[model samples]
Target chain A: MDQGNPLVEETASAVSSLSEEVVRVEGLWKVYGRESKRITSDKYSQMSKDDIRKKTGNIVGLKDVSFSISKGEFFIIMGLSGSGKSTLIRNLIRLIRPTTGRITINGVNITKLSENDLLEFRKKTFGMVFQNYGLLPHLTVLDNAAYGLKVRGLPKGKQYAKAMRFLETVGLSGWEDYYPNELSGGMQQRVGLARALANDPEILLMDEPFSGLDPLIRRQMQDEFIEIQDKLNKTIIFVTHDLSEALKLGDRIAILHDGEIAQIGTPEEIVTVPADSYVQEFVQDASPAKVVTAGSIMVEPEVLLYSWEGPRTALSILKNARRSGAFVVDKKGILLGVTNINRLERIIENPVESQTKRIDASAITKIPSVSEDTILEDLFGIVSANPYPIPVIGENRRLVGVVRTDDIFETISPNRGDQND
Target chain B: MIDFPEIIRIPLRDWIDEIMSWLLNNLETFFDAVGWSILQVMLGFEFVFTHIPWFIFIPLAFLGGWRMLKSLSSGITFALMLFLIGTFGYWEMAMQTLSLVSASVLFSLLIGIPTGILMAQNNRAESIIKPVLDGMQTMPSFVYLIPALMFFGLGRVPSVIATIIYAAPPVIRLTNVGIRTVNPEAVEAAKAFGAKRKQVLWDVQMPLAKPSIMVGVNQTTMMALAMVVIGSMIGAKGLGMEVLLSINRIEVGRGFEAGISIVFLAIIIDRLTFSLSERTSQNNQSHE
Candidate 1:
């Protein structure tokens, strides 16, 4: 739903203007130890986390981290363990206090809030899904899901009603009476998700929520989470160590490395134009076919035949361009069909001027066309099956451009070469 | 063997005696209040246990065992054990002993659980309390009697105090361990959902730590029962006094019957508590 030209900076700027800023974190640092304050200084900040730890006995959890999340955006903070991804997410909710800098959410500076106020702020602001599921073992599924509401001092009837609604949303309707341990890992996480969702907070902060599940279940949960997010339209800040998960679910991913951000970009930008060698190496294995869209690769055709044009005129245009086939469009550029040179020649040789007032219906061959936003991965079968270049259609069935098989191959070949090495 | 140097020997014994005397003099009113409250609670339990007809008590206890253990055989066995104690002609003494054990355990849990929570919450508290808990467990049960006597004088009050000192460590230690070892992710989840510190403790940590804490209670009860004979030396009444009297009179049959009654009581108490802990832990076993 957030489709745009990955290579274009203007589209990204336009998106920022369109969406409201919900969470802004600036120059945030989390240094762990008694002398954590020392590590925030410019001299110690320049050093790596390990080097700083060795010199001052203070471990750096995050260093000068800064990012802002827009409303309804699925923003991902991704890195391996010890990369401060978890720290960043925790810092957002102030579960782990930042040593220095500020976090302003919905225009209020949360870093300055007292502990009492922070607790009250968190209740209305964030719904968190933990990696370990974090369902209370003693509580039944319905009760666990209702824990947030219960803590907020909601009445028993209201709590259960809200919790049951979320449980149904997560497909756990019959499991209300069962304890968390009675369910499998995936179901337990579903309870975790339901608990978070029951609160109906402004943002969903997920910390590798599906990493504990089996791969198949993880994928299923990811898809279901996407559907849920689409329906709810809540801002989500997802943290994960898995690159592909980030690429799949994130509207934009911030790649963190050793307490620093390496890059922040859309999946296509990360794959196609990495910020540095670190980002390039991180995305090296990612198949561009999955991220690159037909719209980005499709080129303007050399020749086109309007439905109003005669076969003689179409033949001359085809002859000038030296092409076997040409796509035909209406006056407003809506794709009608394609006609090759042979079909044009036959129509002209018959000289059916009376019957063929316009281009004959029999002369045109209608082939399958794809929308511009269709990813390259889906185009492989269609591209290989058709002899002619695929027409890239846009809104209202307007023919935007054509994507040749060579374009798909060119977009994917670099990744294939990397994989071989 | 070389003789130890006299100059190097510390006056730790004198220092402790001085401290004990000072507490006896200065905290006499505080000790009296604590002693009176403990005596009243013990008497309340004694009155209830002694007043209930053996017929009604045995059947009720059997029903409790049956419900708690989910087994009719366990209930029947526990009921039979109570009957065996009566046959031994020490049913009255056994009731008195049960009251004392119950009172000691109630106080132990009241104090120990909170202490354990404090220890779990703060590293400094844990470090400070851990060694004291170790001393309570490892010290000879006889040594607690001296302080008990100094604070409450010779009576059931002193015996109750001594029994608590001897019995409270396991519950305190285990409660601390239980709360400390509760799944951290669960606590974090509670906090993330904006649960206050108090809510996190009662709603999350305490319930999750229950099985371990129940085990602690079981151990404390067993230890309190073990203190009965020792408690009788300080003028406490029960099957323990009967055993002490038999020991003094050199009557083997009387001592044997009293000892058998104590054994039966221990067995019945142990099984009921063990079953309770088992029930609490059942949630962990996977049904699938």
Candidate 2:
């Protein structure tokens, strides 16, 4: 299985060691046309995009932006149209040259390379999938997929073999001879992806690759893309305007607004704690239930008791917590079930000398538990059926935390900061 | 009567005439060399085309049509049409005219395609060549003969040169438009894959522009055939000269026979080339 494939196992941990930065951009700025340098100068640095353009007749593509992408991370640059997300991605690959910046990919400062050197660098270091599919119309699917390798001066036999393998990986094995125009939009983009994958570059740069697809196909493609990324575990920098897509696919997402980075964080953090009003409003329409996992909202249960504890002790613990029910777990914290005050009262009525004998096994109610990774919405039905808190379990079914009904309600409701935005 | 004033007499005609005469006088050797080389190629085509007997040539034409258009019926019909030209006793003249048209089309394609590709690549070159192409296409066909006559003298070479000038513009114009109009995304994709400029032009642009270029070839061939009679006015011999002689002697039967033969040849060439272009374009689309 491509999932946990051994080819890239080392890359998963190679990123966090900051010295191993795969891609880094510092003080990047791109202004279109002749006045780029003038517009990015100190005097016009603080101006808005429109103001700078009006003053210097130069459209700012990216403002003084700086970020570093770790190796093997699915980093997303997300923004609305004209917000310069596309420009930033293109600049990283040197497709659109930045007016002022230093871009270091795999520790080589690509921004300083000559034209011939840059072209050669791009051939070896980057593979790009475009929104338009960018498949050559005259070439068949296999030939189109093999194009990158062909231009790199690979032998024809090996090119075709690698192309066929990638095509199979992309699930287009049977349609190798079909041309771009004959295939539907989704299939064409798959060919585009396969073409990039055949190059096997260090990073895959995708710019709105699914935006041109139909909604259903786009959704399916996104899921397939995530699956492929899981298997390949390549460093990917995906640019999209869709917030949901960014949240779903990105290990970390950077939000760009008016040529500047608004915020960058994990999907959960971006949704729950936006950096500013602009980011708050940007995430207002995103469904929090989908973005917020059970782990994010789960709290440590205050009224957990060991099964070895007697009924008298359980009653006292519940009384202190002001809860009618208390969750019982074994030594390793595996959830036994919920034991309430009523069950403890019955055990107390028996009044056996041995506390273990007095405990009523039949009184314990076995309620459904949820895993830490379950989304908030999936817990809604399970929570409404029982009054007890849902135990959040981890590996080996050990209790980690509890998702109370109140947590579900509070997480779904819009944040107080969102209202101010 | 409202008459324009002639206060600004530029003497443009006299200047052009004097320049033309000076070029004719000074570049006689260079013109002779070019004309000699061109004449050799023309005679080569005429020898190959005219030497083959009618029975053998008809079958060869049938095979060409069949292979190109992929239709046996069209091939047979094309063969029958050639037989009709032979029955009119103008087969040799028809072959002569075919050779002339073939040479014009070949040379026009050889020179025009590269020039068109250059124009497509460079904006400055396109700007310079566009007006020249317009002049070449719109100027009267007869006007080209004067330059040809001065350059090469009245003969087969001069007639062929005149025919080339009249017929070559469509190929050049269409080739430029064909390459220029290729989808920019395809070119960008090629470049993104690390293809050099020359590689992109050959591997991507040319294949995509092929249908348009073929259409240009068809139009150029038609125009060349159209210039045959005009070419006969400058000492070229063919069905066109037969028509001219019959008209001068007032032999209506002879003129009619020759004219019909020319029509038959035109239909054969047009149908064959047009179908060839159609077949290739369909092949491209079907794969898609």
Candidate 3:
């Protein structure tokens, strides 16, 4: 908390440094009730599911949910189906209005906009991507890609150029004329992305964008999303139920439960120090050691270190560092050992440790320099890729810690059944 | 010879008796009553377009022409042509025919679009309407003539009534097809945008459906043109009457010329309406 929470930092970075806000929603609400007043009132939302059954009132699609999304942030909202993530995304663009909340976009309360003004605002700001890709079936890739611009009264020639450029950005350069139905799901999603990008909007709202695709495609899309983000640095709010996805893409994620913000934090916070049982259960299978950085687990600069001989072998290094078990290293290349037998077994038994071992400059295999700040999720991935746990190394390639499989397993498998991702 | 037939001579008495009873009781009385009722209805909706001073109609005609066809030359040319028809001594009849056709098509559309929208709203209505539209479409154009005669008379009104029957099917079919074909996702997207029930229909549904509905309108107008010629036999005028007059007099050259004129009219009207639909589609796509 002293260093500033990662979630808060991410949100701050997402908002303008020049200004504290990008988009603010003050008590956003959407209800399927006959009147607008019902959406704003807590009385209706507080009714128990049993009470609702007895009273037989309308369903509350989203309650007075209020959260601001900052600029350049990869904000994620995680929930089960029907948790109103979709409604929340829609409200950002005023595709739906919050019954009671004031949505300020760059200081403009979009809820007060007239129809024409609202259309202009939507046309000018915010790009949207849906799970199904929603490419027009009749249009070719180029046409579909250009639709946002075309719809905004841009001339065809200009629209086509913009569309083609974005199409190439999304890796669909050669697929300009291909129809939606002809393309693969990933290809179609690429087109969807291209279309959204064609307008060059500042904020992106992706509603389970890759959920409808196959698993392989989904993973590829997630990687593609990260790559794109790395290049564009645009603000993004990605909605998903897959916690793994939330971990992979989110800078900070907020879990929604029954139309409320259950918790908001970085992947490490969610996995390690979950706010509640609900948050804890959601991160049950993940190891905090892998998720949290060395900075998080390092015990103040005080630990015993064993200096080993040159060209130290993996078994010897393992014996020396973490002799008590795994020695986590500091940023200054100093060894900080929290190593012990129980930790060693845990690190060695990790599902990783097959293909991710480090190799020497020569063809020979080498050890990995695992720092205390390294996240367990990252460590688990590296460990899974090797048969032996990658030897954690330090400055001049000296051994630091020997991460094991059980370390990861211990991080997770603590207890389940309290959180919804 | 005796067994096969004594020529059925004994049935002559019964035949005479049956004929006399039918004439006295049902056939003669029913025919007269139905004939008179048909004539009266025609006189009811009638308006005197002939006495309206032709110059006043020109601007009104041009306004309609601009709105419907959106062409200056089209509007001006239409006015000139109507004027020419009058100068050529065929104005009164042409105006009558135009009015009848316009009235019938209007009434048909009024009934069709709302009905189609109703049908589009409910699956059961759509199911019921589909077969009815099919039946109406498949029925011979001549079949509409008898019903028109029964309901109205063999004049402008009955002819217009018949044209409605002939021209009505397309609007119903197309309206249903258009509403059905509207993108559900767009509707959903609109809903997500916070578009209310009415906004969804007007902004998303109707605008998207316009192209298909226009095609239906084109089909209806064309059918109306075709039926106008058939309606002329019952006293509706325009080129149809000219064609009939030429045919009656055995003036081969006149009939041929009149027939060619009808073809030209068909081409012109069809192109204009369809082109309007196409332009609208273009406009819709432009905004998208």
Candidate 4:
């Protein structure tokens, strides 16, 4: 009952206030034929697979995608190219109509809108950013930024002011008159960001917007996006092929496989319980403990040992220490230290000061401990912070058998050669 | 020589001569029909041109030049210089050539873009049209006027008809290329945004494809301008006629002036049209 830290309290409040549904898509289907015949069945109607292929002559772009984005959630849809991740977002915008499904946005079926109404819907509702920058090659940055407003018949002066505001926010204030080709890729994406923000959309749709940039710049942009989204709080649907990116940014992520949703959960959920075999392969290569919650690895009560004894006394003092190793807590029973047997080996077998690197009480980043309730992706962030091993917490904030980085990989992907070995 | 004058008046020879006459007449009739179509096009063009105030067209030309060319002042000045040259009585001939070139380019765009669109929509159509367009473009420019004159009898009509074929390839080429090069994702984005089919074509596709379409228009106009002087060789009456008359009469000053006039005309038209098209898609770009 100690609500001590104001910053942590604020974060909890912010997260708790988020609503459950911002976008509800039910049974969404998009079939793109491999051949040239266009798919002509009404996209809103239910159709059998064979019937759709017979009519459209196209391959499946998406197959029965169903998910709802909660407000204040950074929902990432991740897949390799052609996995229909982009198609899912595009269908939400009605940029590509689904072969069949009910896509409800703000409680209205956007699929039923007429052309004029739809244009208005787009103008008023959401903003889009593209990977290519898609900037008009001719216009100055200022003009390009102001394009949507002009197209929507906004008066020149006000649109310019609004564009200028975004230009400043995206850090392109002085270069507003420069053309796109004249700028670097990162700068171009900044302008794209500025343009998307100019409309103050309720939802921001970005399609690999940072994929084309240099790695360093890509990371920098991701950080910048995180900062912006923190303040803007818009429901964002980002599509990317980079797994690391999906883990970093997505509050919840949906893994796509061959036109279907492989798994959808908080990064933690997918990382831990990966819904399908494809998802397993995807997450298997990464260090596993980073993705598994403490609930999965916490030691049983009978196995618990209490003390801050050195690593050398492991055999005599702490029995059933187990291959996973142990965490040391003080008399007050607070987590004070951790040790992994396999990761620790002394130079002359002087095992006391072995590979045990003391993690200061302050050293661990205060992200929540992985729990059954925690998504697998959340553990990844914690594990990534410290590669030695992770401390597992159980009831009464007691030290539990540490989940060795090795054990995590073994749990998620049992097929590999003995991870502990 | 063999005292066979009467003997040589054979029936086979007579029949061969009669056949030659009949074939010649049919050939003449075919040419005549072509010539008449050319005449109608020219007459229609002239009637349209007569309604436009010269002042308005010249200013519009300047506006287009300024729009397309990056250099606005230079474009307007060039447009002004061309107008003055015409007013100093290069006017009639320049207008004559303009009328024909303009008509040819307009029709080429009208015909070529749809053909290009059809081709873009279907590979079979592209396959069929490719060889024909290639042949039409590659045929000798002089060869065009021969058939033109055979039907229209060496007048403006015949010259314009020839010019249309000569100048048309650009519009078709640009239209097809532009439509094809539109970003698939942008179109997909639009569709996902709930954009209708026509909406994808117009808002997402066409706006994205505008720069290419413009390049096509620019090329079409340049080709049309090239053909106009050539058109003048068959009594088309334009700057080409002025250049031709100057050369025939050995008046160097007149020919040189007309040649300069043509260059000025080209610069003006090219710059104006390009700028207009560029301004069409200002916001799509992520960069300045």
Q: Which candidate is the best by DockQ?
A: 1
lDDT of 3 at A403: 53
TM-score of chain A of each: 0.93, 0.88, 0.74, 0.69
For B1-288, candidate 1 gives per-residue lDDT tens digits of: 388877798899999999998998898899999999999999999999999989998898799779988889888988998988888877888999999999999999999999999999999999999999889888998888878887888878988888888899999999999999888788888999888999999998898889999999999999999999999999899999999999999999999989988988998899889888888988843322
RMSD to native for every prediction? 3.1, 3.9, 14.6, 11.2
Instruction: Give each candidate's interface RMSD in Å.
Output: 2.6, 3.1, 7.5, 5.2
How do the residues A155-261 of candidate 2 rate in per-residue lDDT, one tens digit apiece?
99999999999999989999999888889999999999999999998899998999999999999999999888877878999999999999888878999999999
Alpha-carbon error at B98 in model 1, in Å? 0.7
lDDT of 3 by residue, B134-173 (tens): 8777888677676556545566666766777778889888
Q: Residue by residue across A108-184, what tens digits does model 1's lDDT show?
A: 89999998888898888889999998888888999999999998889999999999999999999999999988899
Candidate 4 has a TM-score of: 0.62
Every model's TM-score on chain B: 0.95, 0.95, 0.70, 0.75
Candidate of highest lDDT: 1
Q: Go through the candidates in order and give each one's C-alpha lDDT.
A: 0.88, 0.85, 0.68, 0.70
The true-structure Cα RMSD of candidate 4 reads: 11.2
DockQ of each: 0.59, 0.40, 0.06, 0.14
What TM-score goes with each of the models?
Answer: 0.94, 0.88, 0.59, 0.62
Docking class of 1: medium
C-alpha positional error of residue B14 in candidate 3 after TM-score superposition, expressed in Å: 43
- Which digits, one per residue and each the tens of the lDDT, describe model 2 over residues B25-119? 89899999999988999999999999999999999889977887788987898899899889888888899999999998999999889988999
Off by over 4 Å in 2: A1-14, A17-19, A53-56, A257-262, A273-282, A329-337, A342-374, A378-387, A393-400, A414-421, B1-11, B14-22, B63-67, B70-73, B243-257, B283-288
Tens digits of per-residue lDDT for model 4, A1-421: 1122333335435766866577899877776655422343345235544555566656677877889887767889899987888788888887777777789888878888876788888877888888787665546789767766665667999999999999898888899888877799999888878877887888899989999988999999998888777677888999999888888788788999877788888777777567878898897765443445555664443333344343445433334445454455766665655544443333216544444444323322232343333434455666677754555554455554455555554665655544534
Ranked candidates (lDDT, high to low): 1, 2, 4, 3
DockQ of 4: 0.14
Q: Give the least accurate 10-residue stretch of model 1 chain B, judged by summed lDDT.
A: B279-288
